[model samples]
Target: MTGFRVLFRAACSRVEGTGHLRRCLTLARELVARGASVGVVTEDNPLARSLAFSSANLSVHFVAPGCLFADLIDDVAVVVIDMPKTDEQLSLHPDWIGQLRQADRAGVSVVSLGHVSASADCFRAVIDLYPSRTVHAVNYLEGPEYLILRPEFAASDIADGAFSDQCEANRVLVSMGGSDPQDLTGTAIKALIDTGVTMSVDLVIGSGYCGDLQAWQTQATAAGLELTVHRDLGANDMARLMRQSTLALVAFGTTAYELMALGRVAAAFTHYSWQEASAQRFESLGAIRYLGCAESVLSCRRIAEQVRQLLADRDAMAAMAKKGQALVDGRGACRVADLLQTYAQETRDRQLDLLYVVAHPGDELMGAGATLIRQIDEGLRVGLVVLGEGSASRWNEPGPSQDRELAQRGLKTALQQVADQLGLSAWYYYRFEDNRFDGHDRLDLVKVVESVIRRHCPHTVYTHHPADLNIDHRLCFEAVITATRPQPECPVTTVYSIETPSSTDWGSVLGHGVFQPNWFESVAATLERKLALLELYQSELRDDPHPRSLAAVADQARYWGRRIGVPCAEAFVLQRHLAATISEQKHSERQGES
Candidate 1:
């Protein structure tokens, strides 16, 4: 166990189909670099066979479709499945997954790696592309490994002048898996010629011997494009190539994530699949240039032209490579490694306990929602209990007051705005008398929250800042104090609002007035989102019939922001450390956690 001997089982068949095995090979190399005895077991999909032979630290063990689980588990302290959730992911076949579980039960730690391993609970440790929500790890499972990108990507130390010679400068690799059992390589070569000029061209052919690799080699040579048919390069080499090359004409698959990790500027050309849907966002981020697939060689001319343009601009390509690297650090594999290491080192019986309560829509949105989204995105266990009816009974509009629906519409919109902007979980709202927080029974408020805490047992609770100017905000704060009072041992981290423009005096909100705030927190990263959320209070803006309030709130935050040297910031009055409540047990727990 000290010097772990790990076996990586992967799915590698086609050129495009090789990401799973490729990344697994990357991980194996990482372990080998770390001084572990590493080996690989693959379906022997032709794409993966080369990896077995490439690394000195890796010993190859080939298995056929019908290989039994016992045969797959030979000489392995831990079995790491390196199959991602691409359309070509093959390791999760029921038979293989079942075998891995059996191996785990037999005391061989099962570590599942790849984007595609969804049921994390089934393995001792499951590593993936990013933090996963679809698979619950910290709770039901032993460990959750985050996909670690390779170091070659993070270091960005591309061999100085990997393409120094102008004659060999325009090199690119437009390689995917070998599922095309259809001879797309010949068409791709034809398409490359159609696009423009380049002396050195890397023709990546992985495990898929769809047709004759020899024939494609012949065609590639005839085109005068130096075709390097690499059947045996590890993921580390592939990552190097993605970074060293001026540009890559690739598809929406594991290669994309790898290039994204390497921060290699790439132009995507896909036929169509689930991966394509996510590619739209990748394109928006300028990580990829999209070109739809070609049914035949006739349609690849356009694809070639696109690749041609990228080749012409090395500077632009370098910029994209940096951007891609920023988008994904090769930490995914390391993330998985750490998780597995921790689990292999420890065993525990843990309980998830919590006490969570929140004020209705506006309070949660304006301040708490941003932090909540950050927590949720990290795969934490959390929920909110909002206390307010969807009514604006306390609102004092200049014009004729409207019905409950009309008044609450703005609040609802703002709440929705917070959720959408922060990508937070669906909120749970209650119809309590709004603007009348002062009248809500302290005991009743506490009781409702206490009931929720007992039901969910949340480890942390977030609430409105206790000393805020808004009467409603104050009450929301008080209710949480009362709820957590009984369960003094439970921990609740409280977060308060930066006074909203709607809750302020018109004079101060105008920015020229004297009600300027002295307190602020850098909300620079979330400023646009905050701006957008403020719009949700359409009722507030429309209440005056002038829509001046909309601009007023922004002006106030901006004024404070300018004073603080930040682009934008939200103001807060934190009194959680008041002398009177200094030693209060409830206050003590909420003190440092928040």
Candidate 2:
């Protein structure tokens, strides 16, 4: 309940295969490590049960084959579907689509895996782990960068001197995934025997496999080979076998990716046409030798010949091993987990109506904290960005006593607590020197602001007025203006300038510019929360009568609200506003051109 609840719906069966389940398990393991509660929904097969039993944190939901999942979509943060069987099946599955639609309507995010040919509009995002040339929809995350691999496979080190020509080659690994409906394992074993090589064979058979295990053992013994058959091998055991073996003959799927991660030279074949693309991609990358479909007799002979040649030619095997290792660094699961985390964060951020760009850590709370809390109460996402370190006052004190670094660290911690109290969807800080904006290059400041704006892509932006007494406040206003300028692709449709308690009021006496308010947001319900959050910045708070004093801040909110006939409110100067339609049209035109 503390973390995200992710439900994985995979296409798995004894007759179909377990590749989808295996990949889902890899991602599930990563998610669990990141404090997620994972549930897997698949057919009640031996492999599915085995996977569920292996992970203490995983909950298994057994669905009958060709039947819809039961009512379990509520309360899930994310629903990840890994149905690599077929696009038609994914699209036409009534229960699958209904669950996804229900989750989508309930504000839960949905992600699809290996959805190459399906319509991507049903889900929030689609992930294609293999190298693909097809142009997908905007929500698709394609290419090898998104490949998901188990932690053991990802953490295993590449074999030392594995590519050396003088390295001894003795053992070969033959694994064709959890349920080889076409009996590719039997074919691979026979092909290895036909090679007539004097090497030990490590055959890994899945629990769900319905092949004749006794016949395979007899054939291996008659061919004068030392065969070791492993059943239901776990991830750690598989990694150990892959490391110990000199070469692998695997069906093109998750197993091939595992072998590649371990830097094992492999000749990959496909049992299904859907796997050809992945096999050819690995072959082109020199990571594996593609032996075509395993069902073809000629392809089986080719697999045998390739095994013979690779064993005899140490340099070729080493080159292949090195290439395979180089292609898959084993950190792909981490990358994918990061994306999922970001997507979850962005799901919340998408509801934000405003992003406050401030010059110091406590500026937002001191300026428009009540307004932010009010917006959140009204179900709007609110974000914060503090551009300066806010420690210049401590650093510039007359006494050389305080540790400036320590003071800054404490200020940052206080800012984080304040942000949390305000329920900010996203918060960022740039530790630039406080009150020293004049000393830094303006272009650098602009670029920094631009990056944050691009990331949050908020519909509305709030910053300081340009005519502020504080140099950092004035510069931050200028940078925000430049960063959120009306561009064809920019998401900012409206920008407002708010008054910081110390900076905005002090500038009135200088006659530089008056702090005039054109907008007032009632914060009567949240003024107490705002004041409470402001108290966290003890280093920045002042005694009564000072402009930044707690009492004065409360009085100012009442004063602004009284002018607008409200109990309490925050004031803002409307700087720029654009129609949402105009921005959307420009964005669409730009996308079309691209």
Candidate 3:
């Protein structure tokens, strides 16, 4: 299946804080891993920009403050909105709900993260990891099972023995979300110092924090406290620091969930009234000690006393850790990914038009790359499939027993680049042996192609010509034909066989069936993209006279273009094509006869 293109819109800034941005990035990472192209559209806030840059393989777009949602909702299949919570209301601009309605009417799938005061009817799905009440909607995914923790936190080992020996567990961690706009780090540091327990402190401040760092360092030094200040820490580094600390003083947001994921007992404080629900919920469950709002006058002294008492009582600290771990297991991002994929599949079934299945990793680019690019540029959802591992090219090389592993790894990297360059909505790779398709049972290959057809439900299918010189290409064509045979359940309406630059043209003297192309697709605009993708598979390129050289590829495109009276073109043989009306008529006739 091809990946979906998603747009994530959130509010983030020094005042709004970075929780919304951070959580959105977490979800984006998971979606990207599942082969979705994720773009984050948010306010032009420094914190949001910094956090977006920190995430690899993500596209970030910044909008001016008060920009209409319609301005940022272009060319996306799905849109995720993450509104900041402050006071008692979600930080949604006046036009957000109206824009969401517009997006819904535009056929774009809309999802809302966390609770919002507006009616949920505008969204396709509503996700609140900690829903205060049962949402009676079928699209609502609530409870701790859907908690979206950073990947590092989800993978980290929980601190099951963090408080086993309170005397030795003297390290305290203090993090008040990303911005800490209220400058609560200083207060938390002061409360930690007032404990008078001679504990070391690890303080995390986000890049959005505009506090006086030097003054805080001076105060900690003068107070005879060992304090290490960290800024802009990555997810893994933060998880590592949390594991080394005995207690965490954090705000009631994503950070609190992270602490719970690591089973670190924390004294949670609310930076906003909207955060009080989560804080008090955790406290009531004995997972954390809620210390009211950080702005309260008695909060500093009360938090200090609570931390001191918890450190002194090993049993109490351990109990808290146990309860915290039980509350969150940290697999929410994957669950959310699954839901997004379902939505994407549904969208594609309604909107997609083409699927290209090739025999090997580079075959898609080598055979019909230009055509695929042109189709996608024309607003068609193009899916890709590579049936073989493409590892046989190195099978004869002299190397360690792990040569196969190395080849597979190299091919996987190249194919991923190809997928990204083509902007495919979905991609699938099978591990059938390269150049040795005959070695496997033919039924297996048929089943693989059939499954892909059923999943993607593409209207048009492209594969290699059956007469191609490559054995794998021949087998792939056969499999596609068998799998896509006319059936009431199969949505495939057409199948086109493309010519590989090397294989199709080289079989002329072998007396094999010729590739007689009757269909020519103009690819003048996307010929460069095809060439660029071919370059990514450098290992597969052959020298001059081999017909697979870069120069030969361009020459072939020119020859085909000249034949069709175009600047550049790709040739294809239309093996089968059925109009929807005719297919429905055939089905009706068969049912009547039965």
Candidate 4:
């Protein structure tokens, strides 16, 4: 019974804000890609907005917020929260805190997720602005263990790299706050020039400031300090400017943290009271220099000197950069996901259930990658089922000779290397002769897989995914499906794809605008083992593309690492998660009984 990781629900506050939903989506994608199923539980109010903002691949369900204290879902591995809850008064309600505590007590790791104002007592951990020494002030739990800092921002690796022309401009971004009530951009701009910095500025005003900002932009040109203003910097532009900024001058809030993470140090000028407190806290950590309200700070000649001090000395700049990143790691989403996946594996003995059915040489290695690492590191029992001899194609070559057959025999040797790496049982390969297709219809092949399923009676079955574009991958999906449909102990998970088997020759496939989806999986846990298994696929991914090449598989996984926000990933599209009948019900119940 692999549990799911869920995020908390809430309304009011910044329910429509993309920041909260963005974090949830990142974490969900990471956890779900690993073995653990990841679900999100958010309130209806914010969910509508998030739906427009989120990617369809990530699943987030809207449940009422009132059920906070209820033992909602037992199979949940962790609960993450960052939304604004209005059903209960956060300032006065002990119940809100109690709800989080209840989740912690249930052995479900609780993470009070945040970017700003990130201090949590009830959570097992706080995923937020990281590496900041301010995290050291948390009163409970091991600060380091409970504090999951992200790497993208925590380190200064990208600061000295590059910047946009506009970024280097005295472009001062003024995102008033997540929810800017006062619409304070005009006055803030006035105060800045009043300070006599007279630097050219690109103001990032929000969606709500259309008219006022337009008028100010016109005036900005006339005022003559070489000012150009932009309101609501479109997504791409905002990121570009942030990457290439001399400094970001925003009011104290999450943007401050994000800018800091981007290695752009910002000066804070608080408009509201809580902002003042946050500015103070950030200042204590050397994250930013606060200069009273926007109006007053904008009027002083001393502002230029302060800006020069921050800009001239790279040492102080780097230190401040690190301090800001200390608040949270950009990798928070991925790591939290891995943690929950490990939690799901903890139930293995209690549920001697799922058997990951593999095909060919690198099937298991490429598909169930993250799970393989956890299984081997913990010395867990894993059942292996290799479908064929995994031999290379002899379809077009000279009549199959003894030499070619020995290479065919190489499939078993390669598979053994895989098993040895995983510390798992030997391959129960049906030895139906590898890669050389025994002429058969999709249905007949299904029967053979069906026989395997009946004999194993595994609670969960992992196989090739149906929608896979490769020939054998397609065949595996159809066969696995036919074999598992009628029995009680049939494989619960019908399929997963091994991308290597579906390789495209670079010569035939280049210069085409075709989109390839590579599975993003971390084989690090069993990376050595995975490569060993690939050694078994004697005909896999050859560079010359003589019909077998696994290079595409590994290359694609590395490519995916750069996408979906990770370093390395082996991906598999999920096929099923349901109990279709009484037998399916009993199978699940039986898994629990074990």
Candidate 5:
């Protein structure tokens, strides 16, 4: 019941090819496996119908060609579209752009699978599966790492296929994709025959293949090559055949990525100009050899020469397998599913007023407990993110004990209890090891924080002061600052760094890491609640004179409160404040004058 519904609006036809539908199905299956309700909306084509019938629990709705079923999209959390962003292609579905915009306006996330002609603002993300050397915009998730392939194609260990020179039959897999308009399967078979090498050929044809399969078989047999023509095989069977084969000759499409995922060397031929461009990118990566368009008379000879060259070198073949597998790890469907699910959840969640980034579960309360309670009392939606588990640092041994899991569960329970007590709108926890913040790449921490910031879009952020004695606190501060940079897309306008009890006081003893307070919030009313909340973190609390103890916490609050002429107060360092723009300030001034 917690899972949301995802709808795919795609096309699959003789002219459009089945790649869109196939990849969408792969992603849909992954999402469903992870507890999402998935549906596909496409033209009432035979391919779509057959796939829908074959895939158990998959819902496939049909619509007119070049039509988007806007009515079918009700109650859907996400809509994934796979269409080219070309003028001619956009003309095919006139209402697609408008429908997509309307869906986006309705708070439904729209994700583009490849290239889509819809306006950029309509899409929550553009996941480009094609290979690219250059960096894309932030919203576009490009390259082979995001390439969606069937789960069956995933391989754990890639063993190099022995290129047997003495073997009578060298296995060559030829697939021209669904509906090979240029008869590339036939072209590949003819090229294999021309290679003059005795081989066992597996001709995998698709449901959309309009070419004469009998002619391909006859030609292969006449040329003294073993031919096995497989028609519309299931993904598992196809993956099995691909694993058994030594090399694959495929058209530039989803199959190419699948072959790469299987760690099988491939040589690709393109049927379209865009496909040729994509093929060149693969060629550059050395994962697959590009043999150009199959329509040219010289293309067959080029394919024959490349096959001969690749089949002869065992080392080269092994290297290609490594590069291909490295490029495509077969978890693309999972990654795409993650993108869809994240966008869906982010769209569904309400924005937060303040987001506190801390190094541990209790760090938020330890630093700004009274201030946070005051904000919640004032009707502000507050959230918290703990970057580390704060468990590993407590262990005296080098490794963790069996009690670690139990301890983590207890910590989670305590976090939920704190959330319930503080009336927080949200609370997030990451499993970064406690006390090992310095061991991790700083950008990794930054990226995680950035993802959260982008999701919640909080206006104000509070994090640990950078000069704290704890390394995790310092790293958390750096990550929050970097993640909340003054970008036009970011919603954060102010950031404050709070002082932890022991870490900040101890860090100040080093002289260089002195704590300086520039802002103070009177917490006179919530002082008792802050002390009560400290009871939830009993493990983190200390006795009597320790800075983290209840008595010391109250003493520090009274100390800061006296400086600011209040009964109790929380102090903070104003780390960053993005002042209003001239236009914004003028607008505010005009309203104030009224």
Candidate 6:
């Protein structure tokens, strides 16, 4: 999980618009903040290049136009598609289907932002930011809550307290998205003129706007409407203008969501069927007033009347603003980042070779720490799971709650350091009561162990011996046994029981079965490193005469080494190992019958 990577593939141009690439940049910043290395792949266009240059930390790769999704899946864990559902983009590469199959076969996860035409099933996840009422797929993440708006729109210092009915609202903000491919900005201006209301109009246009601005200015002057045109404003300046406006007249896109996040009531117009679907959903939430589709000639009149009604009735505007602000919290990027990180970690954990389950803090170090280090050095991926709090046993009565919390925090920090030093692929620490394993039901421990076993899917597992004097150690052994019970789906094929020094030594005196070792691993090179790591748990070590002491641990290593004819070794009793020859034996039987 050290180099978790994500690559975003999006399209941008005069026709496709720049919203897809811009939103990907916003989400990329959030992923980088969470320690993910992010890159963006988009068409080599002027607008995309300018926007990409603004985000300095992100690695941007420019591809030829209409070939944005071709040959871009490199050493990344996940590929996010933010392209439109246009017919031209979909038909650009005939081998798009085969490319997706190859990525799947190579263990790469593909996620989509918005619907891809005729290929929804090819994606691992479809994040529809503007979804309709019916659920599309089980993996489809929907609604305005997942809208990826810039963080500036959700700042704390901008106060949108209440709309005042006493003061007549005059300012109106108009933006027709990055590219008004259908010239909806002209329709919005005509609608504003038809409203016959005296208000200051602030028109915002993006880099892709190709309309006749001079003609629009002439018409506004003739209509006696006060108009100020702002071109290509950045996020901070746009947010500043949004804060000053009482209402927004916008096309259906990222601007609509930004208006909702800022509580600026907006009446939306749509050019595409998908945009209309999103508008209807937002209108149903009382966030925006959806004027019917802009494709119809009469929709202009509809927008005109709605603008008149909204300007006249301040109470309705207040209600709409409150609902819109409450609907979007502007943290969708963070949620999406969390989803990608989880998938990346799971992808990494599936390659694990060994997992060690223990009962307490220093138990792993005392038992098979040297062996764990040796296997990891030989390029075997290893993980660790601690099942108890490792501290509450020090208290006589139920200890002060705050003191226990502090001790638990310290132990977690120490485990993090140990995992880093040992280069473990994954590690988890759970807090079952320290020495109270007997008080809990046996099934509960089995379920927890089973859950971890299913996630990591290690080929070999190591746990405490069943004959240990400690109650937690005995229960831990039982849990691992039941969790790894032989089934066709279980990845575990071998299980070994390692001896903890003090607990295993005292078990024989109390009439419990002694640990008889049948497997010994040479740890001549890693024994010193294991002893160094034990210093992290100094509170758990004792004097020279005790079996848990540092000198006594080295002496025990020598004793096990002498028995196995090695300089140093760790001994284990191999309880179970399901040999991997069943498939071979079945093949031989079928050949003989033939």
Please list the Cα RMSD from the true structure of every candidate, rounded to 1 decimal place. 13.9, 15.2, 16.7, 20.5, 12.0, 13.8
Give the C-alpha lDDT of model 4.
0.51
TM-scores of the candidates are 0.50, 0.60, 0.57, 0.46, 0.63, 0.60
Top TM-score hit: 5
lDDT of 4 by residue, 183-241 (tens): 45665555555545446676675543333666766766666656655554544576566
**Tens-digit lDDT track of model 5 for 1-594:** 146889998778877778888788888888887888888887797877876777767888888876776478888889888864433565566676778778877778777777632345466666767633222112444556678877677655445432333323479899988789888887888899989988898888888888888887888899999998898898888887877878889888788888888777888888876666678867766778888785555467777998999888867877877777877777878767876876676567657889999998899998799999999999987888887877767877654322543465567557758987787776666657789888878976787677656656798999998778988999999999998999899899999999899998888655546789999998889988999998998778999899999999999999999999989889999988988899998996899599
- Compared with the true structure, all predictions reach lDDT values of 0.54, 0.75, 0.76, 0.51, 0.78, 0.78
lDDT of each residue in 1-594, candidate 3, tens digit only: 245688888778888888887788888888877778888888886677777778757888888877645355666778887875411233355556667767666667777777643444456666776555333211344556578998777734553534455336589888987788878888888788788888888889888788887888898889888989888788879988888888888887788888778777888777776667767766776778887775556566777898899888878888888777776778878877776775666564434578888988888888688888888888898888787867765678655433443455567668867776677876766656678889878987787677556555788999999888888888899999999999999888899999887788876665768999999988888888788889889888999877889888888888899998998888999999986688888996898599
The Cα error of candidate 2 at residue 259, in Å, is: 1.4
lDDT of 2 by residue, 1-594 (tens): 236677888877776678788777778878887887777788876667876787656777888777555767666777777876546675566566666556665667677776543443346666667533442222444444456787787735544525543337578888988888888888888888889889999999987889999999999999998999999898889988888888888878778877777777778778867667767867776778987785555455667888888888877777888777766767778876765675566655345568998888888988788888888878787777777767865555454322443465468669767866777776666556667777777976787666556555688999998878998898899998998888897889899999888789888766668999999999988888988888899999999999899999999999998999999989999999986588888997898599
Q: How would you order the candidates by lDDT, starting with the best?
A: 6, 5, 3, 2, 1, 4
> For model 4, what is the alpha-carbon lDDT of residue 466?
47
Instruction: Using lDDT as the measure, name the better of candidate 1 and candidate 4.
Output: 1
- The list of candidate 3 runs beyond 4 A from truth reads 1-3, 68-72, 86-92, 133-139, 155-167, 349-594
User: Could you tell me the C-alpha RMSD of candidate 1 in Å?
Assistant: 13.9
Tens digit of per-residue lDDT, candidate 1, span 141-247:
11111335556655344443222333236777767554544455556676777775855667666555466778766766777778776754555677657655666
Clashing pairs in 6: none
- Backbone clashes for every candidate come to 35, 1, 6, 34, 1, 0
Off by more than 4 A, model 6: 69-72, 86-92, 116-122, 133-138, 155-157, 161-167, 351-594
Clashing residue pairs in candidate 2 are: 352-381
Q: Candidate 6, overall lDDT?
A: 0.78
Pick the winner on lDDT between candidates 1 and 6. 6
